[model samples]
Target: MNTDNGLAPLRHRNRWRFSGGTVDLHRPDLPARTATLGAEPAPVVLDPTRTAVIVVDLQNDFCAPDGWLAGIGVDVSVLAPAVDLSAQVVAAARAAGLPVIWLNWGNRPDQANLPPGVAHVYDPRGTGEGIGSRTAPSRAPVLTKDSWGAALTDGVGSAPGDLHVDKYRMSGFWDTPLDSVLRNLRVDTLVFAGVNSDQCVYATLVDAACLGYDVVLLTDASATTSPSYCHDATVYNVRQCYGFTASTPDLLDALAAARPLDAGHRTAPTTPKDSE
Candidate 1:
């Protein structure tokens, strides 16, 4: 099945390969690498080849002690636990050959894209500390692109093959290429984990469900600096309304049980593919 010459197009759905004289658009014999998750809202199932883990806003601006939220006097301790847990879940997803996508809030320097309502969320009185007011303590403009605050939490590992999406709004799908990226990767199932369980993570999960992607949230790997009830409600809502919820440990066990070399481990691409 060496497709170096582009003779074999991986025989998978959504993977359109082009070669010297032609484009292979056939969906004749796609492979379904099914992996079962011991998820709540019933035992969830999916094709590992068509699944991806979307790690949302596990960034310093939200999880770090000196991050934007913390600097603004919010207790980031509650969100701190999501850092290592997200890393663990991401590692398992990578080993299983599932694509890992890091979706963080990387705002523009001028903040032209942000509307009045969105900007008002953090700086109610327009105190000049919200989205793009700058003057950050960490030297990196608060959540601005390529800043310290927007970078992934120190321990969370992202590889060369991992995809990174910068979101403008709370929902990653809004005004972002996230959905297109997932579709191009031939992914239909999204596994979610990140900080602020009631905010960005939940918003993105709900949007994903509406778009018809089978979503599964890793509860322990996603937390919030908000009240405990907010976190709990998000988990319950995801299982009851959006998609499904499962623990990180459970996902790891399921991934181990469904270890197939071609299901994103040995056979998955080492570099990002512009098109599948």
Candidate 2:
């Protein structure tokens, strides 16, 4: 199922199977009745049009080779696929006209209110520079704070129509304008992808679910310090506890299908005249 963009179609495996007192058959080719076995009707299909992709803290400190955690035994190799997936998701979202919000972490001059031992390990000021000093491009609408070592890196900037939100906690919505932004965008579903899957990503998903937003965790578009624990916990929580967990390819397919129909209505026809 190659999309128009030249990306291959998402791969789906059939899990359903047909079994009876005397007969058995593969699921995909089985008749609906045989497969259902007197079960209830099929589940309702969700409309992905109201979905938005929220990228959380894909920064130098977490994803790049010379990041703060680089020396802490963080295996960034797991992040390579995530970065590629993120790029694919972004491209698909932009093409389909869906919103792609990048939540970057930034720091202030004073490292006030930081978690104990965090400042010692990760230097906010470029002075004690570690491997993760490169920041996102200035063009991005960043949320700069000193509380957590999650600020957005340099070089990545927000585009003209993109929205930026700031936070001072693990959850992006904890003390930020995230809810308001989602409301304004009419976003009912959120696709999450970013760094530190076990910590920030998990926290955001839990919060998002609590706020009544349908969430999808892009398993391949996220990573953590300890690849084993981070990846395992993320998959477990998303699949069993929080919400739907999908691979980057599946997520891209869903987003591409939903974007065209949803994007047009979310934006205003004319730019508001603030008189510049």
Measured against the true structure, the TM-scores of the candidates, in listed sequence, are 0.88, 0.65
lDDT of each residue in 1-276, candidate 2, tens digit only = 111122222111123233444333332221111000111121113444456788887765566555545544567666767776777776776565557677756544443644535444445463654322333232222223432234433333334454556555678885577887787666677888877788878888899999999787777788776647767867886767666777776655544444244333334232222112
Per-residue alpha-carbon lDDT of candidate 1 for residues 1-276, written as tens digits (9 for 90 to 100): 101121212223355555455676653233567678898889987787778999999887777777788787888787656788888888888787778888999998888888888889878887788876554556468878878788887778567567789998989998899998888777888999997789999999999999999999989999887888998999899988988999988888888887474544345432223233
In angstroms, how far off is 223's CA in candidate 1? 0.3
CA lDDT of every candidate: 0.79, 0.57
In terms of TM-score, which candidate is strongest? 1
- lDDT accuracy of residue 170 in candidate 2: 70
TM for candidate 2 is: 0.65
Q: What lDDT does candidate 2 reach at residue 226? A: 62
